[model samples]
Target: MKVTLKLPKPRNPLVAPARARKAGAHASYNPARKVRRTEKHKLNQALSGRKTEGSYDA
Candidate 1:
């Protein structure tokens, strides 16, 4: 007598998670969106003489 072994089906890696599979789901961070400060804000910072650099200032 011969016996056959059963194996589980493999999941598809290309498939997105259930939460992401839903419609109208958007990521918190979108690269196309402008995130950096505007030129006006930069000018204000320069005028204020505030150092935006890291711990090197301390």
Candidate 2:
């Protein structure tokens, strides 16, 4: 015995985004700043299990 399956047609993609934009305000993306020394040191220590040795103050 053999069986066949049928799938429904996909809806138009353009209709969804237009409806969403009209409903609410759109969001904007902003770039992030460079990481701080303290943050970098902590991340390094967490990953390597050792404190970084260096002069942080210039």
Candidate 3:
């Protein structure tokens, strides 16, 4: 017979303040943040059809 154990989450970790100020209603969501974080070398679908040869990616 085999046994499995479920472990509890950890505690006592120090906390760090966010570098960016929290934005209210004026804040906008970047659809690209998800793609940039999860997938490497992949561009956000939101920007799949946009042009960037003007100044970026140099």
Candidate 4:
């Protein structure tokens, strides 16, 4: 019996960085959609309850 192995195609690395930059630019332009102090505090508090670490880092 003979067996053949197949390799996956390589990804286009350039596409990813370009897409990330575009997303970052769009997020920067839309200031209102950004998270506010109250929302952030609530999110942190909710996460603290579930996570033993108590806070999200970086």
Candidate 5:
């Protein structure tokens, strides 16, 4: 016997969720993005041997 299922197509993730009732999970509301961006910025600065105003090292 063969079984099959029909599912809705995947949704776009980059657009805002509430705007025009867009599909996909909320990409903008994620709190981790800011944290990751900041962390990556610091890490990049550290790797490039650039001094920042903050006391961040390593």
Candidate 6:
């Protein structure tokens, strides 16, 4: 009779979500200076009930 051993799978880093994978905020060309940073602006937009496009401020 022969016995078999089971091996456990190794844990890997969790893949970041699509939103989280996005780049951080940055300064863009805004004469009105409405959106200074992309990330911060996005958050502010969400709070203000504005549509967020998740685009860089470049």
Kindly list the per-residue Cα lDDT of model 3 for residues 1-58, writing each as its tens digit.
9998998987545433443556476435776865576453334533674544342352
In the range 1-58, model 2's lDDT, one tens digit per residue, is 8998898999999988988875643453323323465566677776685654462333
Q: How would you order the candidates by lDDT, starting with the best?
A: 5, 4, 6, 2, 1, 3
TM-score of 1: 0.24
Candidate 4 C-alpha lDDT tens digits along 1-58? 8998898999998998888773535446555555576557667777768634545544
* C-alpha lDDT values of all predictions: 0.58, 0.62, 0.52, 0.65, 0.76, 0.64
lDDT over C-alpha atoms for residue 35 of model 2: 46
List candidate 1 stretches off by more than 4 Å.
1-37, 52-58
Which candidate leads in lDDT? 5
Residue by residue across 1-58, what tens digits does model 1's lDDT show?
9998898898887776764766774785665443343545565666677745331221
Where in model 6 is the C-alpha error above 4 Å?
Answer: 1-36, 52-58
What is the lDDT for 1 in model 1? 94
Candidate 5 versus the native: TM-score? 0.41
Off by over 4 Å in 4: 1-3, 23-58
Q: How close to the true structure is residue 23 of candidate 3, measured as C-alpha lDDT?
A: 46
Candidate 5 lDDT tens digits, 27-52: 77867897898888988887788956
Query: Can you give the lDDT of residue 52 in candidate 3?
Result: 46
Please give the lDDT score for candidate 3. Answer: 0.52
lDDT of 2 at 44: 75
Clash-forming residue pairs, model 2: none
**Residue 40, model 3: Cα distance from true site in angstroms:** 50
Pairs of residues at least 3 apart in sequence or in different chains that clash in candidate 5:
none
